[model samples]
Target: MHQLDPQMPPVLVFHGDADKLVSPRQALALRDRLLASGNRCELHLVPGGGHNFGQDVPAWQEKSRALLRDFLARQGLLP
Candidate 1:
């Protein structure tokens, strides 16, 4: 892991529990590291989910979309 800047912007990370290409543990580790450095971070773990979530998008319904919107709004990326 690279050195994190405490003043860096907030980060949102999504990872699938069943992802084969990337380990979800890594995402958690990064989040922890960022938190330790006093950086804003959010981690969302999709249960029984894989790398691709196209099919699961519907399952997520509007919740994920709302979460993204809220995150963006917090960073002043949304009006």
Candidate 2:
């Protein structure tokens, strides 16, 4: 993780409660670790959402998309 290039782009991480593959806590831990290693990472925990995050389209993934849009807008990723 620490080996990652510092020049990489800022990242936004989203996790869902229904994810059986990986615990939501694990996602949070990774986010923390990234921050600790001086990487910019934002994590959002989606309620009633799963690992697939309503896959195939953004509309299908409102929880993740909404959070990401708000974060990105705050970060000036979009006007």
Give one digit per residue, the lDDT tens place, for model 1 in 15-74: 777788899999999999999999999998887777875355556546668889999998
Give the whole-model CA lDDT for all candidates, comma-separated.
Answer: 0.82, 0.73
Question: Candidate 1 versus the native: TM-score?
Answer: 0.84
Q: Go through the candidates in order and give the clash count of each.
A: 0, 0
Candidate 2 lands at a TM-score of 0.67
The CA lDDT at 69 in model 2 is 81
Global Cα RMSD, each model = 1.7, 3.4
Predicted candidate 2 versus true structure: per-residue lDDT over 1-79, tens digit per residue: 5465556667788777678888998888877877776778987776766787676234547666677788888888877
Residue 14 shift from truth in candidate 2, angstroms: 1.1
Backbone clash tally (model 1): 0
Residue 68's C-alpha lDDT in candidate 2?
Answer: 74
Report residue 60 deviation for candidate 2 (angstroms).
7.7
